[model samples]
Target chain A: MPNILVVEDSPTMRQLIGFAMKRIASSRVIEATDGIDALKKLSSEKIDLILADINMPVMDGLKLVSLVRSNPAYKDIPIIIITTEGAEEDKKRALAIGANAYLPKPIQTQELIKLVNSFISQ
Target chain B: MERETSIGKKADEFLQLFRKGEEFTHEILKENERLRFKLAQLEEAIERSGDEAKIRLYEERIKFTEDELNSLKERFRQVEEENKDFAAKYVEVEDENNNLANLYVASYQLHSTLDFNEVLRIVLEIVINLIGAEKFSVLLIEEKTNELIPVGAEGISISDVPKVRFGEGIIGTAAKEGESYFSENIHNLHNRGSISTETPIVCIPLKIKEHVIGVIAIYSLLLQKEKFSNVDYELFNLLAGHAATAIFSSRLYTQSERKLTTIQSFLDMLKEKPRR
Candidate 1:
């Protein structure tokens, strides 16, 4: 029943994340090309969670997180930042700006599903 | 007077006999009371013995119940342990399944496009997303020059990458020999961004059958990738075959298209000329 929004620039990465998200029982995966496309999808659907990559074209994930946090209607939704940035500063910044969790790639799909499920089941 | 003395003595005798009878009756009553007391003590002892037997029976039942409860508790613990092991195994299997899915997706996308540039882009994406390569390039062997030229690159500029002749260096030799090279010191590198033209961490030669077409050289992996995994080796094998075919076929298709266009233009020019 949870709707997960996946925002990534690479089509292959997007497909990879989407494939993992679909394994969650009764969960619907909404794909977006980048942060801008994520925002567009956000307006149309009631997104339960957001899995976004920090490095993306058009708009990055941090900007998306900031935008989502500022908005009253979408503020409560959980956001998981998936990125290749393994630096502590990047992780701390993402959390400080309102990302619920940070996951670095190369992504373990099992871990990804478990983390999402935890947030959804909460 | 003699007769009166005789009667008084007889009376005295009768009184003495009555007193002796009264003493006998008192002794008998005392003996009966003592016997009753002994009987009461014996009955109480018997009752006490019966209560002890019941207590012993209840104690045995309680001991049995306690043992049964402990057995059940142990069984529950075992079941819980088994469930935990199953959960761990399930996670492992799921991870394996996801790895397979990555392979499937990478292979599917590689062959999905016939555009030469698109094919190169897919290869780069697979290397980045699946293989976790950070600094890498797809170099095709230039037929005329017999050199490997960078067709696609990430993390380093394509112009900066050096071209080497076939069978020259590690990468070139990999292409020439149609073999994959994985550096033993891949995990020992301190600076991941430093470009080493001669020493790439991995070089997978792309081949169509026995003909080596190109090579995918990976200089550095992502910061989080400590080493290559089994699935990564499988991906390399897959890329060696499928990516090579895709790239080769797409290049051939593009070349043939250009040749067809040029030939059509020449035919049009010939038709346009007026007969003398």
Candidate 2:
């Protein structure tokens, strides 16, 4: 089973994402409240993929993506940004920052599952 | 004795001639029988060859018929595909025509009367019925304060509507810059403290000659529409100019009408005083 990391500020959002992921495939999910917590988990655990929210308290998703991209060890890991910011500029910035994919809020459960499965299998 | 010997020789010659004639007759009979058998064999062969030719002809005809049938089927299939294509194109063209018609009707209705409330009603109708927006609000800019005041709204309680200052929120920013702001996700506005109820999918500034007079906030689309189409954007552009003009003209007409009524009443009062 692959280990997945979910970084979000909201507990409900984290649970929703976790439920969607677990329903799609049997995998280990490590939850983090924000980017700072995510980094802490990353150092100790071998994470296969990351699903992160854009807005957070300590560090935002964009900053996390930039930091992850700069790190040589975790540079190649796939990062999917899920946020309520569906503007064209937001999408462009996320993709430019090395995020693998961007999913808008009011997330389609099946599409999210499919996207996760594709990334994990890859 | 000489005479007897001569007579015997003539008798022997006659008997030999008779035997030769009999042998010739038998040979002719045998030859005739052989020719009849060969003729029968040739006739049977000819008949069999004729039957084979007929069979070959029938086989060719069957093959030809099958090929013709297949060709016809292919033609039918192609025609059906063409018809389907034509039908799809027709529907597409019809949809385009309907959109254009709607724009025309909306333009006409906006300019139909100089009543400000009527103009707002018509705009709301176009937004709801034609554009398929479920929730929307029309806010006019107060010239003195440079704040947006909601004149009309749907899917929002009047008590809950918040006044937006110019250059503050998305609506205010749109009005301040005289630019339209369309957000596919409403959370961006929520982040800035503009909208509290539902997310607005579109925010358009009603402009007349680079001057934004008002703003239209579309909160959400109908369930059927996942996103705004190009046509919706076109409609937005149209509303930006035409809606502003309509509202401006109606306000002017109303003000002028009010002034005229006041003057007429004053004249009537003076005339009555003189008659008394």
Candidate 3:
């Protein structure tokens, strides 16, 4: 079972994703309110994967992704940027920053589950 | 930035050096005295009220400068408070969203029992509780009157909303234009004597398609003036859509029930045996 880290500024979004993931995945879900906090958790915890939201205060998810990819300890951990921003440029940037996947907000649960499974399988 | 700091330091050093130089310092003192003598000579005319217009002009200039200084001070205060409030909102939205308020709204929207008034009350609750507005109201659009009539309200006397109309007040203009407005400082603004305090008013237009449906108005006691976020717009629009759908559905339900009764009574009459 993969331990998933969920980073989002919105509680509703966190719950929506957490609930959906709980229903679908055999993983221990952890939460972080913002990118800085997310960074701390990624370092201290053994996180297998991540689901992060963009447009957060204190440090944004894009910066967080770059940070995570740069860190030697957490570099290989698959981070999927799950955000409301659905622009292609944002998607490309996320991937370019070493994000494993990108899912837009109000994420369809089934699709999210499929993506998670594919990531875990790989 | 460093150059600006260096310039300030150099100016302080220059003043110190000027004070150290006795000869140059005496010369500067004489120059100041000469300027003061000239200023006093010119000041005699206005001081004696030789020309009332000139005196009035000086008074007005003094008042204008004072007012400008006060305004700048207020602007500084507003900006500082605004930044603090922004930080607070960031904290709040993070914390409140943790409570699943969005899901609550979503589920609430799905419930058919909430009439327009009830829905508005709920919306008002969101505004007051979550958004931190001191006063909030949802005024429904009356097509007949072309006015936004108050449906649900908070932090206002009923006497305040005495038959408000379009083109009548600030709210009216906002509602009429179907545009959101945020007056950070409302001292110079008019509101038909409805709003008493010289506070900021944030008016959000509620519309569905081309028809303006309502207005969500809130008054800010804080320096925060951001009236509506994307989430707010989305939720307000969703709530409006919910209101419209629920209204149509309920009306249809009532019509069906009436028809069902009529059909039942007609069948009852048809079942009766005919007399020869």
TM-score to native of every candidate shown: 0.87, 0.59, 0.38
Residue-wise C-alpha lDDT for candidate 2, range A1-122, written one tens digit per residue? 88899998855456657766765567989999999999999999999999999988999999999999999999999999987666778989999999999987645555677898999888
User: How much is A109 displaced in model 2, in angstroms?
Assistant: 31
Tell me the chain A TM-score of model 1. 0.98
Rate residue B139 of model 1 by lDDT: 94
Top candidate by TM-score: 1
After superposing candidate 1, which stretches have Cα over 4 Å from the reference?
B1-20, B143-145, B208-211, B259-276
The pairs that clash in candidate 1 are: none
Chain A TM-score of candidate 2 vs. true chain A? 0.98
- RMSD value for candidate 1: 3.0
Report the poorest 10 consecutive residues by lDDT, candidate 2 chain B: B186-195
Give the C-alpha lDDT of model 2.
0.81
In model 2, state the lDDT of residue A1. Answer: 81
Candidate 3 backbone collisions, by pair: A11-B97, A11-B98, A12-B97
Docking class of 3: incorrect
Per-structure clash totals for the candidates: 0, 0, 3
**Among all windows of ten consecutive residues in candidate 3 chain B, which has the lowest summed lDDT?**
B220-229
Q: Which candidate comes out best when scored by DockQ?
A: 1
lDDT tens string, model 3, A1-122?
A: 78889998765556566766775557878899999999888778889888888778899999999998888988988888876555688889889889989976545455677888778777
Error (Å) of candidate 2 at residue A36 is 65
lDDT by residue (tens digit), candidate 1, B88-169: 9997898789889999889899999899999999999899888888888889999999999988899888987889899999
